[model samples]
Each structure stands twice: as structure tokens, then as C-alpha cells.
Target: MRPMRLLGLKTFRHGVHPPESKDETSGLPIRQFPFAPLLIVPLVQHMGAPSIPVVEEGQEVQRGQRIARPDGFMSVSMHAPASGLVRRVALAPSISGRMVPAVYLEPFPGSTQEIEDGTPCPLEATPEEIIAAIQDAGVVGLGGAAFPTHVKLKIPEGKFVDTLIINGVECEPFLTTDHRVMLEESRDIFTGIRYLLKVTGAENVIIAVEANKADAAEHLRETFPSDLNGSVEVLQVKYPQGAEKMLFSALLGREVPSRGLPLDIHALCCNVATTAQVGQLLPRGRGIQERVITVTGPAVKRKGNYRIPIGTPLRFLLEHVGVADDVNRVFLGGPMMGAAAPSLEISITKGTSGVTAFTDTAAERTHSPVYPCIRCGYCVDACPIFLDPALLGKLAATEQFSTMTDEHHLMDCFECGSCSFVCPSHIPLVQRFRAAKAAVRKSKAGAA
Candidate 1:
């Protein structure tokens, strides 16, 4: 209707502002990180079913080869990151610490960048073909979640998606990969949107960028020539604003039901980097080989955005990037909501957007020794989900899984880390609640 009267800067009600370490490379252009001698690709990069292994250890595979096939509708295929021989198809350490199945490839020295089977397709492909092409490309959400884009675009039978909300809000501190991609690959981002709109039958396409990245917003607004058939809206800068529900709330002023997705609210949000890759893959018919990752933290020597390959070992990435020799912790994503790695020896996955090397000092403020809650209600004020994280934290502390979900609405929590970040008593609210949720889910599964 009435152009919605420029909401100015829209955002959710609550969130905490952690240090925005994005300055190191916020303005830097996207550059290809040099191919490591060995690439460690994972089998379950997407959210659902894991891919089925197609290549065996020591299998001589060429560049653009299919290393694994989609396990089901929920899964996407895995491809060779480079022209190289498969070194091993075994369990490898992931950034999360646990061993996950991986395809190790030692790149052929001076491997050709040329694809062996690049059948260029015209952009005028039908919706079904475009969806199939996306699946063939093995593209997943490059923004942290790693959800299969093909699946996301598949609007359920009678359901209609009214808007395609492309996420350009790199709200996570220390991650500027999306910002650089927006500035550098605006064309690719648009290309991906054209196909996404066609496939999803979405009449509206809105690119959502945060107000903090004003330079990136200005660059895209200037470059896109709004004369094109799309909408770009700059959102209010807020922590967790990049999250699906928060961004949807900021743009549309709607809240996705607890434990529900944006699709439930007639919306679809895709990361700018993922869409850019969709642009690259829809035509070339290739799989995800590598992606942009922001490497930063107090311990790092050269902190900036890096275009790292899938399955690149964290140890190698950190060492190459020049982190301080003695590091206390390494986080796989941003300081908030990211999983801390047990060690730096884990391999990067499709969801690995930033490898944050937090030294003793950098990791200090975000956490503090837990103390008895004074019923301060600070967490209540800080929670974007409106759930009582303080109560959830209490339940988790006492191993009360049922109470956390049934009474406290633990599932509603996105684990945005705001509760943990804002707690004066230094409570690890998010981590404990996550464990409680997992236990409840397991118990429910057993009951079923």
C-alpha cells in the first residue's frame, strides 16, 4: 500500500551491542584466499540430512567433481573445492570439535581454475530448471546457517511467499564478509535475486542491510540503480538484528512464531553471500568450493576477510592468517552465538563464516564467573525473544529441561547470546539453555 512511510531505522525491541570488530576489513574488497595444499570438505554442511559419500579414499577426482550426493530432500550435494585427488574420505575434526565425515583433497600443484564440465546456461531458465540448477550447484546459505537454498526456495504446495527478504545485515561483530560481498558482488547478488524471485514466484524482493554498514548500503544503493525491479531497505543497527526473526521484525514488523521460521510468516530471508554464490552456481552449474570468511580477534596478525575453501582446516587458516602463538580460545563464527572450538585443528564448513581467535583479553568481557541471580530482570529486558532467560538459566542450572521449554519457552530462544552477553552475574545462559533444549528434544523423541 502506501510505501509504508519510511520507517526510518526499524529493529526489534531488545539486543546487546558487543564490540563491532568489523572495521579491520569492512571496506576491504573481496579477494580469493590462496588455495591451501589440502582442502577438507564436510558431508553435512546443510541443516538437514547429511550427504551420501560418493568418492572413496584415494579416489582420483577432478575439479568440479561430485564428492557426495544429496542424502534426501533436506540435504545438498558436496563438490570438489579444487582440481585434486581425493586424499581421504574419513572423519575429520570440525570447528565444533567433534569428528565429522570429510573429504580431504590435496590440491594438484597449479591446479587449473577451469571447470571440466562448465555448461553455461542462459538466465531465462524456467522456475523448475532454476531450482534444479541450484540443487546441482550444491549451494547452501553461506550465512552461518548453511540451510539448503533449493529447499528454502521450494514453496510448499499451496503456500505463497509474498516477499523475498535478502539479508545483507552482517550484525555479527568481526564478520565483514557479507559487507565486502555486497560492495563487490552486487551484480551477482542481483543475479541470484532474479532467479530466486522467478523460482519462488515472489512479487517483491527487498535487500535488507544494517544501518551500521552505511558505506556498504550507500555503495549498493548507488550501484544497483534502483531502476531495476527490486527493493533495498537499510535496517536499524542492532545486535541479533541479522537473525531471521529480528530482521523480519525490523523490516515487516512481524514476529515469526516461537520455533517457527520466516516462511511461516510468508517471508524468505537469504544471505547476500549465499545469493551471490547462487548467482555464480546457477549458470556455471558448479558446487560450493570456497567462501568468504572474516578472520579476526585480538590474537590475529592479519585480520580481514578471506575467501577460504570448504573444508579448510582451522589450524591452517589461523596459522596462515598469523594468529598469536598462544591463544586461549577460537570461535567459529561471531563472538555472539558462535560455537567455540575445542582447538584450532578443526576444518571449516559451509557455515563457517568467521574464524574468531579470541585471546585472554578479547574473551574476557563477554563472560564472567557465574553468581546467584539477584532476580535483577536485566536478562528479561535484554531478551529479544521475550523469553525469561534468567528462569531458563535457573532451570538449566538445576538440569530442569522440561521447565525451560514448557514454562520458559526455551525453543523460542535463537540462542542469540544476548542474555549471556548482558547478564551482570556472567551467566552462560545461552549455552545451558541449549543443552536443556537438546535434552528435552531427546526425551520427546524417546516418548514418541
Candidate 2:
């Protein structure tokens, strides 16, 4: 392996490291998860405005056929996973606990794996054209955030993106989807970087990985430059190191101001999987009807990485993957910050990067009642973004939404769930902040 000509960038301050159950699935290669007979495609799968449904009930659609269209600037389109008959497009139960618009499809028996819809995306596509192609490809950040990649690629006026920071550091525990993608899909990653460089016009491209995944780092180190004009960089294996602001800081020595974006620092950060998907889909002009996900946990009997079609029912995934016996708790992503679904019956979305299941014994039961803060200041020390979660929780409890912003930097909280993780009182500190922030937004709109 060649030595890295590494330019170690400045990273952000304090963060914590919870137990990362990475070994359970990190070594496993990618495999296809058996398609669920029925799919529930969420309209708001990708970050941004909800996609407007175009397909109607009983319509026979081919694989890769567009079922939804971009409703706004920050949205991406949705596609049929397989050549299937559209059962219906109606309000369905989502992982978000509401009836969001979803497209229900019954997979056609023995549907051939075929879904290419447009001319090959040239590496030299113009900035506008590239963004359009990316949007057309249905590319969104696959790291659970699901932000539209086209929006990130399109730099606004007066904003020059000199650096394209690739997030290779999969900091979240039990989530090896990014790590496995880096290991197995090196070619796709390189191809993705080429497109990113061309679209963003970035002079420098950096792939930041943690020290733990030295193999992934080494693989990228050898393949990146050969793949494009940019470079790959290895950094300290730190939690939240993959966060845009933190990754920018770690690789570029710049800090994105609170409530600002990496764009503010003249940098554009993208998930490695997003780039890999871009490489795979853009040339074929295919929409993101499927994504790679890591399904592993103590509860799962057969744990490995699987390429699951978007909109497949989560229960089917669990059952097919040998979770038939265990799996009382299911996490959509990583355990540290991932959302817990009450049941596995909800359908997977574009953002479903990993499906983590825990057995009854493995699932930690927090029987202790929520107690008052002892002023231990543990959450204060653990916060990576440097917000006082204790105060925010208290204010939220008292319905002081206005004070949460006027005094505390409530909007700055990205709801990373760091504070909640370290809270000695078992308080749902992050949830309180989320509620408070939502309330503040509501109050502001009411005032207007």
C-alpha cells in the first residue's frame, strides 16, 4: 500500500464514543436482500419537499419507472423498485409515526432486473446539467439524512466550493454500511468522486476515514487518485467525525459557523455512499429504487450487509434475514442517534442505511424514572456541538420556547442525540430540544 500524502485538517471539539457494535457486520460483504412482495414507498423519503405522486392505482409500471417527481428545489424523484403493478398510492403508516403519502406496489412475478432510463451521464456535464442529472438519478445522502445530492452539488453565487470533502468516517456505532461500501464498492466510489469534482469544480477532494478502518482507508488511498484528479485523507477515528461541519474542520482546518453549512466554509461535504450511488445511477440515468444497508445486531440471527430495494417492508427484511425468532427492538440506522420504530412492519425508505435488531435480553430496558438533573454536567462535557442540553430540556419542560432561542442557541442543535446519550438522569434531552425547536418555529410563524 502506498503512503498517504495526508493533509490532516482541523477537527471540531468535544464528542463521545458509545459502544460501537461494528464487528457484528463490518466484515460481511454486500448481498441482495430478498425483495418484499409488497412495497410502501414514502413520498418524503428524500430530504426536502415531499415528492408529488404521479402513478395511479392498478397501473402496470416497469422497474425504474418514475412514480414521483420533485416537488421543490431540494427534493429528488422516486422510482418503482421492480416491474410491478401499482396497487395504490395512498396515505400509509411510515417510520415517522404518521400516515405519509406512499406508493404501494406488488412486485411482478420474476421481474427482470432492468431499469435504465436516460442517456449516459457524461463526466463533463455542465454544473447545471450535472445537478439536473443527479436530480434525475434520484441521488440523496444515503447516511440516513437523505439530503438531496443535487442541492449540495449546486453551489450558489458568490459561494466558491474549492474542496469536496467525502465522508468516509462512519462514526456511528453498529452502522457499517458506509464502511462496507468503501471496502466493496471502491470503483463506484471513485466514479462518484469524478462526477462530484466535475459538478462542483472543486480543486481538492478529500476522503476522510477513521483510523479503525485502516483497510477501507488503504483501499481508498490507492484507488482515489487513480480514479480522479483529487486525493484521499485519513484522520483520527472520532465520533461525529463524519458530520459535515466536523469533517470539514478535521480535513480542512475550518469551522462552519453554528446554524451555517459547510458551504459557508467554501466546502461541499457529501456522503461516500451518495457519491458511489451517483457513479452507479447517473451514467445509466436510473432512479434510486434501492440502497445498500447493514442489518446486524444481537437480535438478528443472520446479520450481514444487504442491498435492499427502497420501499420494501422492514418486517420482510427481518424475516428473510433470520430475525424470525428474535428482534423485539429495531433501529433504522445506528443505535447512538438512530430512530427506533415500534414495529418492523414499516417500509424502508431511501434513507434506510441499516436495519439493527436487538433481542429481548440485548435490548437495554431503562426502567428508571426520569429524574431531575443532579448538576453533574456530564451532558455538558459530552456535547460535540457545545449546546447546553440541560437548560434546553428544562425550558422545553416549562413550555418556554421563546427563551430556548432568545437565550439558548436552540436552533443550533442538529438533534445528534449526544446529550441524551450521556445524560445521567436518563432524560430525553435531545427530544426536548427537538420539540422546543419545532415549537419555536411554530411560534415564529404564528407571529408573522
Candidate 3:
């Protein structure tokens, strides 16, 4: 392990320190959320082709039954969150504000919610076999990326991974789902680590946690398996510390090349919650039906972490949790890096990590006046990727999308929001960069 720095904690170079705002719910334990009357299971939850529906309208599906099968290697299967009647298969609102194919289900009121078991993948299974089982289980990066976990485990030909970095750094403020997971599900995490080690062929592992979650770090350390070849490392508290690139850099003192992946540095980083789910589900022969979510904020009356079923409508969630009447805005994740919900009609998906609601009073406070860039270089200092957000913002204002990507390494930003958060001018640098990157992608696709 790399030598510790200031205060005996390892950390990356550039990042902001936003108000954590996690106290309201971080102490709370995870609770199973009541099933919604109508669950809208989006087939396109992960980052790939949408899954194809296997059941038609009016078909009865038991809890954990496969409702949709993966379209291709890039996609993942979907399961019923509860035993219910398939109301319809149609386009439904997703958190992205797009209407995608979804399976609407009316859960049976008094049916036993038993999960269907599939073939269990033992530790001795071949790497290829284990990866296939992961895909079958519909496991994805639970750290809000929603990228298929099975695909990530498949190291490209001719490349090798030496280290597996388990990310427990819940850097995004107000999201304690990971913290709770580490405290409550250490066994599943260790079991998952064994599978991950076999899949990646990593010689050793490192469970990275931030200073803020010392309790979780300690808990994992105490329960850590003696047979495993890794240890837990506490990192300095910093925004975006949970990012794969940042975590690897802090732990191994290695920098992933711009526009590159962890595998480029012979390392693999997986979210702690995602790892635990892999351990919890793979042995049970079950697919992902629900995930833990941190639901909290000023406008929420009963804020806490919830084991929420995938496809639970945001409207229903907020209603059940008791939101204030004057709640002005709600974000699917934390304030930093999370997108604002365009409509409450949009349902939760695999990537939904936290539901943060804000009151009108808080919204008004946050909607501060924007001013011209003062060239203070605060964004430059805050950006974790070492990009000049000041210049990027200037380019974005002039609609120079191509220039931004071609000349400034715009695609490497990852939309961490550190630049926007630290900008005294309130320039919305991250938002502009997101639009610029999208424009660049569209232009490239059109040219192709």
C-alpha cells in the first residue's frame, strides 16, 4: 500500500469539500420499503441495449422471476420486484426524461414475496462461468454508473489486473447507502470479493473507505476474512473520492491515462454495495430486483436508507416517505453530480442511489445569481481530473463544442460537479460541459 499522507489518510490531489449534509440519515439503518401498488420496471435500466420483455400483458410473474432477457452481451436481464400481474409492456418515463420500454406490474396484495432461485455459481467455477452468472443475475455498478458489472469483470484480451480496489468512499454528500451496506453486510462483501478476485485474477485487494466512514472501515476490518489477501485503507475525506480513477490513484499512487480505464493501470475498482449484492445474490441464485437507496434531504419527513425495489415511481416513494408540500426540487442522487428530476413520474432504476428532496426555501437559497467568470481559478483547483474548467466554460459559452472536446480533453471530465461547486461565479461549468460533450457525441455520430 502507498504511504499515508497528511493525517495518516491517503487521498487524490484535486477535489472540493462540499458540506456532507449526511447527518440526517447516516445514522439510520436500512429498511425495506413497502412495494408500490404499481411498479414500472424499465427494461433499459443499465447502460446498453434495452432488455427484451419475455412476458406479455396480463401475465403473472412471481417475485424475482425473469420478466425480460438481455438483448445482447452488453445488456442485462430484468426481474419482477414483486409477485404481480403484468399490467402492460409499454414506454414508461425514466429518470433520464425519456420514455423507454417498461414492464408495468400490479403486485398481488397478499401473495408471499418469495424469490426464485437460479443456478448457484460456486467459487471453483471458471472465470468465464462466474462472469456469465453475474450477467444472469443482472448485477451492475451500484455506484450510480449502472454499467453492467459482468462486462466490467471481463478483462480485455492480453491485459491483466493485479489489484482489485473495492470502493467504499461515499464522497457524494447525503448518500449513506454504501456506509450502511458496509456496516450491515460485511459477509456478503467478503464473499463478493472472493468472486471478484477469481474473476479479475487480482493477486491482492484493497477496500478503500473515506475518513468520514471510519466506523464502516473498522467494521469491515474486524470482519475481514483471514484467507483474503487484502486490507482496508482509509482515505482523506474529499468530494469525488469514490470515483474509480481517484480511488485507484489514492491507493496505488497511479494515474489512469486520460480517457482510459482502471484496467489500463492493471487495477479494477468496484463499488462496495455492488460487490455485496454480487455476494448476496449469486449464491442465492437470484437476480437484482431491489437495491438499497439513501432517501433523505430537508423536505423529507422520515429520511433514511431504504431497500427499494427497482422501478418504484419517485412520486410513490416521496409520498410514502412523506415529503413536504412545498418541496420544490428532488434529485435522484446527491446534489453534487446528480441530475435534477424533470418529473416525479420518472421511476427509479438500477442506478438510482439516493433520492434527495429540497424545499422551496432551500431551492431559493441555492438559486444564487450567476456572474461572469472572475478568472479566480477555483474551478481549476477543484477539478479532480486536472482539467481547466475556466477555459471549458468559456468555450461552451461560444458553442465551441468540437473545440472543447478536440483541444481541451473535455470528454475526460466525468461531470463530477466539483468545478461548478467551487466556482464563485456560479458558472454551471459542469452542466455546460455535459451539453458540450453530448453535442460532440451527436456530431461525431452524424459524421459517421
Best by TM-score: 3
lDDT of each: 0.81, 0.82, 0.92
- Per-candidate TM-scores read 0.95, 0.94, 0.98
Weakest lDDT window of 10 consecutive positions for candidate 1: 1-10
Report the C-alpha displacement of residue 229, candidate 2, in angstroms.
Answer: 4.1
Q: How close is candidate 1 to the true structure, as a TM-score?
A: 0.95
User: What is the full ranking by lDDT, best candidate first?
Assistant: 3, 2, 1
Query: How many residue pairs collide in each prediction?
Result: 1, 4, 0
**Deviation in Å, model 1, residue 179 alpha carbon:** 0.3
RMSD of 1: 2.3
> What would you estimate as the lDDT of candidate 3?
0.92
Please give the lDDT score at residue 80 for candidate 2.
87
Q: Estimate the overall C-alpha local distance difference test score of candidate 1.
A: 0.81
Candidate 1, residue 216: CA error in Å? 1.4
Tens-place lDDT per residue, model 3, 414-441, is: 9999998888888888889988988989
